[model samples]
Target: MVDAYLSLGSNIGERETQLQLAIEQLNMTPGIRVKRVSLIYETKPVGYVDQPDFLNLCVSIETNLPPFQLLQACLEIETRLHRVRKERWGPRTIDIDILLYGKSIIEDEHLSIPHPRMSERAFVMIPLNDIASDVIEPRSNKLIRTLVQPDDSVVKYK
Candidate 1:
């Protein structure tokens, strides 16, 4: 099995419930085992500022599926949860991103493993650090804890 990290967020109706439901669906998928999950966090929206704040967290999983397959699974989960990708960086019922896929580096028209912005997004970094402090950015080869500033405005919800 390969280790992977996923970042999940919701900014629309029943945000926390959407996150929990997504986790439940992930757990139900065959060949995917939900291992560790960071505490949920409340943070302001990143790109599109006019929407509601987001509830975000990261999950660590051991999966037998390959990177693209895992991405497909995540997309399916989002669709099931009522996600509508009408606008770039817009609010949604659920948004899930593959933050890291073991040590793999993949660049294709559809996906980029070790998500391109994992290092720069506090919502991704904070919860990720909670689960895997020593995790490193594949491209930069720097520990995530070292690359992210500590003062980012992410706070645990529970």
Candidate 2:
């Protein structure tokens, strides 16, 4: 199985519950096993500053499925959670982003592994550091712990 990391966030409805529900659905999917999860953090919205603060967390999983299939599975979970894509970075019930997939670097129309903007978002990096601080991001060949986290407000909520 390939080790993968997922970033889950929500700002509408029950935010923390949305993340938990997404994790549950990911675990329920075939060829995937939820391994470790970071502390849920409350973070201010990034792109769309006018939305509610988001509850974000990182998830480590072992999956036998390939990248695209894994992306599909994540998309399915988001859909089940009533996510709407009316605007980019807009408020949503749930958002699941593929942060890392094994040691591979992937750049495709549908997705990008080692999520292109992970390093820029403390909401993703801080939680990533919690579970896999020493893990190297293939793109940079540097330890994830060494990557700088944005100076944004992130509070442990759970």
Error of 1 at 131 (Å): 0.3
TM-score of candidate 2 versus the correct structure, residues matched by position: 0.97
After superposition, candidate 2 runs with Cα above 4 Å error: 150-152
Among the numbered candidates, top lDDT falls to 2
In the range 42-144, model 1's lDDT, one tens digit per residue, is 9999778999999999999999999989999999999999999999999999999998999999999999988888887888888998888898778888887
Query: Worst 10-residue stretch by lDDT in candidate 1?
Result: 144-153
Question: What lDDT is reached at residue 133 by model 2?
Answer: 93
Q: For residues 1-158, what per-residue lDDT tens digits would candidate 2 score against the true structure?
A: 89999999999998878988999999999999999999999999988899999999999999999999999999999999999999999999999999999999999888988899999889999998899898899999999899956554988887
Clashing pairs in 1: none
Residue 110 error for model 2, in Å? 1.1
